[model samples]
Target: MMSWSHHLIITPILLPMATAALLLLIDERNRTTKALISLVSILLLAMNAVVLFRIESGPNDFENVYLLGNWAAPFGIVLVIDGLSALMLLLASLLAVASHVFALARWHAVGAHYHSLFQLLLVGVNGAFLTGDLFNLFVFFEVMLAASYGLLLHGTGTLRVKAGMHYIAVNLVAALFFLIGVSLIYGTAGTLNMADLALRMPQMEPDRLMLMEAGAGVLGVAFLIKVGMWPLCFWLPGAYSAASAPVAGMFAILSKVGIYVILRLTMLLFGSGPSAGFGADVLLFGGIATLVFGTIGVLASQALGRLAGYSVLVSSGTLLMVLGINDGIVSSGALLYLVSSTLTIGAFFMLIELVERGQDAGANVLAVTMEAYGDGEEHDMAEGEGVTMPGTMAILGVCFAACGILLSGLPPLSGFIAKFAMLSAMMGTGSIGTTPGAAVWTLIVLVIFSGIAALIAMTRAGIRTFWGSLEGTVPRVLVVEVVPVMFLLSLTLLLTIEAGPVMRYMDATIRTLANPAAYIDAVRNAVVIEGWGPGTGAKAGGSL
Candidate 1:
């Protein structure tokens, strides 16, 4: 009999997948039905998260694998949900719910197929988190990418279509590389199961180890391409900025998937030791370069959308750099920072869309400032024509300011806490006389300096756009506009309140990561199945 823990692992993925199917049969105009269905699925997924969290929090030591049709491991399809997978699933579910709520007001603007694609995207994300096999991860990647193709260009505008095409092209190439890498690993290891592969990797001959590392390196490149680190990140800002608001929020989760995979497989397969040189350096140096480059882009970008997009790049780089640090403390801090930065930045992106909507309603950002300054609407107008006022720019300004402080790493905000954790970890490492080399020190310096620069840019832009001068028209604000921003901000605050618990969770996860043998042991002892081929049999694939 399948365990209840297995059900928890499958529910989040299944809920969205099943919901997408049901939603497809419903009429496009039946917003009420569509919403109710979505809500139900979201609730179910949320419940699954709560259950999985409870399981992980217990002293029982959870690592449940569900085999489709009771076929057992190796040959059969499997879904493995461990602490890492559960945490990611919970985060993805929370974001999905928030994004769905935000879409309610904007759905009309987004047109048909919007909700469908969104659900499909969630399914892909959930499946990616749950799948225990390598090829299945690729399958989920394709599923998400196809939905993104539709969602990215939903409105069919020229700019959006062009950007979407570029996004699709780049990812398609990356996907192909991912496939090639997976094929190579399967051929060499003779098994595609992740846990099994992890158990077998360390025993491989030196030449075979080189071959495996090469394949893994190729796979890492594909993920790095997705994560928007340095050179591979060129397509991100323009593409994300051009996409719809909900799409942009979805993309926020998308980039993180790459890093999630890297963190997972790197620790699981390659072992979290100093010997993983090429991989570690690639992440470290590339991450530093990405941070500096993204900071420069953030400084130069004028549009709020583009700035938020670049901020994603910077955050990805920062997080990956922590991954490269290879220390439990640093990795733990990085994990915390990832959650903080994603929420903070995602909220900001949503807020930008709201601001743009308000501006479009004839209330200019400047009009909000003028209203506060007692300058008449006419005075705010550029010509003899009358300009309209938006009631919501002030609210948008406050949200923007909060996001700015969070992004810029100002005190008391959650962003500050994340960065402080990272810097403190790094300094602690240095103090232990391990002496992170000159390269690490250089990266540390550049990251700090670029952060300062990015802060200056955000301040200048926010002051000029929201508080500095009067503009022609103001955008009207709606409850829909404020709700998403509030939702994300509340999450940010929640992170602050439960810092101790969250940090402990991260540390526990880090400890698990630092010891891959525990994972291998769990899988090896879990079960033995009958009726599989020799290579795919119960025994672990040939040792690394």
Candidate 2:
């Protein structure tokens, strides 16, 4: 029997799967029941995530891997948990909780099976994070994409439908690439188990090695598309901007799924051996280009929704660039940045709907145009012109400012700390790591410029929405809706307050990732309980 502690590895996937199934059976008319069930399930998953993080956060480097059907890795399926996956698990669950609560305000009822699809999306995300098998990674990828398809079209509108269609088409092609890539890997390595594949890489013949890299390159393309890489990401802004608030907020973490896979595979398989630096230049340059594009979009966007969407690209590009650098110290900061940016953006996405609720159609565009060409005449003061800002407007303004500060990497926030950590580490100002002159400096400039662009864009939008529109009617916001935004923003605030401990945790995660031996050995040495078969129902436990 597996230890109860070890069983925690599968709960993130299992809990959501069960919740989604249960939710499906519940009548959609009883949406309150469905919502409560889904929310409670996610909240429990959040608790599970906390426990898993604590389990992995200790001094020990030994990771937990639960072998399926009482069979070991390189043969049977396994769910593995280490510091990174635990962190990601926590991030995903917490984001889900916030988005779900936000949806309950009204968005859930507008769509059919919203709760079910949402839970299924969680299943796919957690499964992808946990699985050690490459084939299952593809399975989870499809599951995630599939659920996302329904969620993207949840509150269907013409713009949303069009965006959803494009999203589906793009991901379908990417899925094909994912299949081809995985098949090639299995064909050459004779295993779909990631650890086993990593172990096999050193012994592969040169021809087989070349083929494997080709496969990995193809695989990278699929994830890059998901990561919203330039040229491949044209569909992203539209889809993201078109989705309803809660779904869009949840979608904030979707790109990170691709980043996680790329990091896991790149570091495990290609981080060393014959292909140590094989595809670094491509990702490095590609990441830079992506930042450039995302920044341009940020500055050029007049609509708040589209700006938030482009901001996702900026986040993806930053992480990819850091990963391409391949330094553990820099990666630690990137991890922090990932958490901060995701939470900030999630809050921003939810907040955008609330802020825009009171604005006139084309107000964003008109606001931008008026700024550029100037409104011809000044308006005479009306009777209520000097009225103070409403309580709701004040709250929204504060949240908006918090988001702007976080996204811009401004001072005293988690975003600033995360960016500072990465930059200092990259520049060799930190305790470890060194940077090259031209290329790294170029990346450094782009990173800084992206932050500045975010600042400019966010500031302009803020002025338009809060300052200029202060006299406008306050949008009717429910406590349920705004609290979720506050919840996400507050977490970022907590991240700032606890930066040292979080980064220390991040350091441990990067260390574990650096030592691929730890992961490979954990899988290889995992044992089934003695005298215990798959269905024996023994009360014993296996060593992890």
Candidate 3:
């Protein structure tokens, strides 16, 4: 008999796995039944996530740690639920529900196993968020990538197939790096459990310590690839643009999965250990470069789909830069920004499909004409040719404006609030040494400039689609599709309304993360099975 606390921690993973398996048994033609099941599973997962969050946030000294089969930590599988994991679980659930609902309008039928793959993807993502050990994290990472490969090619166009193949090849290489890194860490640290590794890191010999750092560096590279960090992110825009709308919406959370792992490991393994500040410089500078790259991509993008893809890069880069700063205060604000930006980008991806539907053919022709000749007047002729639908343009216009505000960190929305919080936190850090450092100045300048670029790109795109191109045929958007976009945007509004409580929660989470003792203690003290002891089970180089 398991307690509610134990059940809640695993529900996000188990429920999805079970649901996906069940969906696989159902016929593809039973679309109604499949949709209902997926919706129910997502709703239940969201409810469970809320419960887990409340329990973690409550006044309790004991951590919400669960050991599978009653096995103790550092010896067997463990799942730990802290404020950060709870927040991520909640965010993943919300995005999952919205994407699923939006897919029911059309995308679900575009592929054979969309519903099953969607649930499996959630299983992977939620598992990654909750797992407390390194090996399991790798397992979940593979699960996620496997499902994402299918989702990326769901619609099955030539462009999608090519992009999907590229995406798969890149991730396969990353996965190889992940395995090598994990193997090296296990060999060096003598344990696969994160908490146990943290405990042992301070006591290791200098040679082994160097080996551990090398392993961690390799691991960091693997995660950076997933996060779309610079030089390794060439596949992102093309892959994202090729994906169907709902699938692309879900992909927004996928990059954050990498960011989450970096934050978790940075705090757990290195925050106060001998390796403290190990990768901070690389993350800091690399993040700034990634931000600059993303902003340039955003400014130069001609298509809304590509712009949404670049926007994901910008969000990832922003969080990475902040995490690189390595201040608890700034991290608290970055966490808020994480939630706001993920939602906004997900909504933006969904909205892009509807906004671009009316001018797809014209845009393609213009691209070809421009490429064939130096310049062309095709775009002028294509503009204002769309047919006007009474309420369609108005609804899309409002949603597009909301996405713009959120992306650009404009006033009154959650994006502005999040960026303001981060800026204030950074300023509170005061000048680095005697004068302000170049990184600090760069961060400030980029934040402002990125917003301006996003504003210009979104505004230009919006005018072309809504105001400038009224002569084109009106996009036929289903109510189901439109509602999900509204729901996502409305949640951003709710975040704005509930800014006080949310920020306080994020602040508390950061404090907990900064002090790693609590996390280590919880894992070390987790309940043990009857037969297992510290030295009795799988140790380093032994079968796990």
Best by TM-score: 2
The digit string of per-residue lDDT tens for model 1 on 1-544 reads: 2335556667777888888899889898887788878867887887788788778766774546665544545666677766787788888877777777777775534578676788899889888987878889999988988998888888767899899999999999899999999988887888888888876676778777777787888888889999999899999998999887767876888899999999988788766332354488788878888998898999877677889999999899898887777777878778878888888877887788876653443344444455468654343455765433355666777788788887887877777777777777676553344656676677678767767876887887676566553443466656865787778877878888888888888889888877877666554455533454322235221111
Candidate 2 at residue 348, lDDT? Answer: 96
> Candidates sorted by TM-score, descending order?
2, 3, 1
Per-residue lDDT, model 1, residue 348, is 81
Candidate with the greatest lDDT versus the true structure: 2
Better model by lDDT: candidate 2 vs candidate 3: 2
Q: Model 1 segments beyond 4 Å from truth? A: 3-5, 61-63, 272-275, 358-391, 429-436, 528-544
* 503 Cα displacement, candidate 2 (Å): 0.9
Candidate 2 structure quality by residue, lDDT tens digits, 239-324: 99999999999999999999999999888888888989767887788889889999999999989999999999999999989888
| Candidate 3: tens digits of C-alpha lDDT, residues 1-544 | 3344566787899999999999999999999899999999999999998888887677764346777766677887988888999999999999998999999988898779899999999999999999999999999999999999999999867999999999999999999999999999999988999989999999999999999999999998999999999988899999998999999999999999999999999998889767998899888888888899999999998788899999988998899899888987778779989999999989989998988876754664464355558463455557676555568888999999999999999999999999988887676543222333677778978988999999999987887777656346688989999998999999999999999999889989988888888888788876553445443342211101
TM-score of each: 0.89, 0.96, 0.92
The per-model lDDT (C-alpha) reads: 0.76, 0.89, 0.87
Could you tally the backbone clashes for each prediction?
14, 0, 9
